[model samples]
Target: MFPFKMSEGNPNDGPTPQPANPTSPCPCRDDTKGTQRYETKEQEADSAQESCYSLFTVTQKRWIVFLVAAAGMFSPMSSFIYYPAINSIASGLNTSVELINLTITSYMAVSGVVPTVVGNAADGLGRRPIYILTMLIYLVANIGLALQNSFPALLVLRMVQSAGSSGTISLGYGVISDITTPAERGSYVGLLLLGPNVAPPLGPIVGGVVSSKLGKLLDSDYASVARTHGLEVNRVFGDDLRNFPIEKARLRSVFYIIMGASLSILAYGWLLCFHVHFSAPLVMQFIIGATSTAIFTILGALLTDINSSASSTAAASANVIRCALAATGLAVVETMVQKIGPGWCFTIFSGITAAMGPLLLLERERGLGWRNKIYQGNGGSG
Candidate 1:
């Protein structure tokens, strides 16, 4: 009798099986998903430990993403920051308004075209190096633009500026993907996008103020100086402060900011609901805008950290998605408000914003666990 009972007609009934050959590929092992097969559990554990130990901590990674988001802001802000200077530029260059307007066209064209090339380069060459190169190009272009005397110089320099600034947002997205995981990506992505969103409305206001304060410098020196200062500031934080814990440093401020934002949004909604003073709610609107701006920047950076392998393309895809959603939201918001009344409209939005809080927290917890697993080989380690 067989030591081990074998059922009649079973696959093993024909013969006693020999032990699996450790030197040969296991026939029973299905590797369709590309998971590496180790000879033993000990080998797998050692591999995981090595992989985890090489990665940067969550804090360090976030700081890098934050800098990328800051750099990314220059592109969208540049789009509208020049609006107040159009007429000034026309007069300064002794050119027609129509001719000067073509500068905008050229800038927009370069902005769209440059990102694809830069993003691809970033994917292949690495994020930090590509960012520095682009920024340098943008700085040089800005200086030339400030010194320009004719419409041709203005047009050419603007294109150069666009080429330099356009790819930054893409690079920021790539950096985010490098450090973050898919589970917590949404909130981080939302944070990173804040700059572009905030810039649109504030751009004109800032441009008008800057133009008024520095009328002579508007087309002569202000743009170059401002660009230079921004670059210097970014370099300090991005490069000089590389050793600081990024996620911890940045996120510590977020709780208070979010709390204040939530209260302001709620107050704004309540004021509208009760038909109270309009001006108070308007002030609250500004507060909400300011707080939300920071929130979005944080979220955007967090989103990209989850998927590092194809970060550049992911960033590009995200920008397209953001544009589409924003367009759709704008299209429907007015209709929704008209039907529901301003108070209810705001209340609905407030609820939506509030809902994001828990989701963010959940992602944060998951992200921390994921980071620990990646860097520590297990969640049990501190």
Candidate 2:
């Protein structure tokens, strides 16, 4: 499979041999290929094998991975932790359960959007500064939540908490681009997500939300290879990031993943009918957690692979779509259950998810052609 085509060889493979004809003219300046103008996927793969460099020592990388993974615990922790207390919060605020659920909905909706600003800033600014800023916000939000009395205060504080936490996922991916090469990235990313995946089931019982810069080009072997390729580190793919079929490159690696997540969500929904059993729903939550984490982790890696540098912006774009869909689902789920009951309600959602399989098949077949046509329409800069 084309699978982002970033690299396909074993990690130990050597760099591509120097172009016999460096004087043969760079393919990059051509409107058709731009900087990503690889003569073949294997060539890019070889270059990747050669470029897998990192300044961090193995022990240091382990620490950094643990830190990023730990940061992932925040988003879900904030959400799941608050769920068990929903009733108590409603009682304290003298509000109905519906209004408290509105708070939940608001938290998720904000989670969907706040990443745009944080992630964009993380891309342009440095990941370290953004990380510190958001954590401070998270800290303050926690204090405010602890003191919150009114329903509005609770609502606002939850949103603030979401704002502080959600962007970390995007930034986590950006870091992945920095420390790991494509050949070994998937596993490292899985490690980075340990916090997120492990947090969900335990979160309601304890309650907590736990938990990016282009400077990366300076830190790893990618920088060396990018220099050799005559590509700009600031714009890794090129000036026009759209020149590559990025959607295809990313999704190409995760086709089965999309379907697997669909099945898991379907099962999760049906199990929600038995939420009173506690463990039953939590077990399904655990399964869905694993599947969803795989989807995010893989997609994040692919986005980093295709974009202009390994970017937080690219990763944030994926988060925007993912969180938005989730927020929409959360917003309407209660009404759907009341209207049609959980069985019919979730079956419809699952069906919608299943429908994507065929469409993705179509995307796999024609996405490149469609992108090419658009490329022509964009006057070759696409």
Candidate 3:
């Protein structure tokens, strides 16, 4: 029933605005008040603007950017962590330090080369599976290194390890592109720069401890056996068994330690594959691998997202070129360090890598200008 009846001579046949009400039933609402409709074009536009603004809120956008940048850091962390252990590894295996250094060089070479080839594969194959597989490969390689006695085997395994590990770093950028807008991309890009820059100092410190302390522990039993033999004590365990008794126990203990370490690595790898949760230090190297992989993946995704939303193909191509140039410069620096000494090389290269942080800051400032222009042009069209 109508709340108000129209008089026969009412001027209500023409369009008339409804009276504003404090608590009256809205004309926009149905009887149940479960649904409402926008009656004017202005109302629809206002609703859409609010939604867009909500979606691009400063806090949400900053986190998305942060995650992407964190992802990019993994690659450099994973790559640099093993450099300090090269000389110790060489001594343990009775090989020359130069030969061990080649393994490091080869690993770097593989990392640099594999990403270019796999970058396309990642776009086609998707991100999660490739990342899991790469982590597994890295886990296996570390296990192999711990167990292996031969230099050739180590070399080949290092290559395989690097091939798998490097793919995630490259694919991460692409994933970021899928998620972020162009105007917001530079912050994410800056995060990617943090990975390589921050890793060098951290990597070497860990590497130094592992190589020095662990290496000494590993060789202690052998050193003890040599000393005992000079004192006319039997190094051999028993008359029946040909092996040294104390040495055998030490070897068994070594095997147990290696086995424990290997299992920890495997467990983390499985966790990564199955998306299980884990803590660090308990798993040590695996934790490093996971953290590094995750960081790189996140940053890559942010970069990709920004590029996809905001950049033309030409602009994206320019970014790639810039990345390549930076890599080339790094290579030249690395070569100089190899010729001089690692200490000087690392110091200089570390400085260069650190400089990336400031570069990212500058780029982020520039990106804001570009973002405004794009938004203005889009607004003008609308």
Q: Write the per-residue lDDT of candidate 2 for residues 1-38, one digit (tens) a residue.
A: 22122235775674445445655664555554643455
In the predicted model 2, the residue pairs found to clash are 71-211, 73-210, 74-209, 74-210, 74-211, 77-208, 77-209, 78-209, 242-382, 243-382
Can you write out model 3's per-residue Cα lDDT over 1-382, one digit (the tens) per residue?
2244344566766544454553576666555333433355667877766544134455664575455335444556666777778787888889999898888777767766667656655566765666676678777887886788899998998888777666554555654454433323334443444444456675433443333233234234434543564422321210111222222212322333333434444444444444444554335554343333332322333334334432223223433554466567666855764586444544454344345445444543454455556657888331
Alpha-carbon deviation at 106 in model 1, angstroms: 1.8
Give model 3 RMSD, 1 decimal: 23.9
| Position 241, candidate 3: lDDT | 12
lDDT of 1 by residue, 156-186 (tens): 8889999999888888777656665432343
lDDT of each: 0.62, 0.67, 0.50
lDDT, residue 375, candidate 2:
67
Q: Could you say which candidate leads in lDDT?
A: 2
Model 3 local distance difference test score:
0.50
Better of 1 and 3 by lDDT: 1
Structural similarity to truth (TM-score) of each candidate: 0.48, 0.64, 0.43
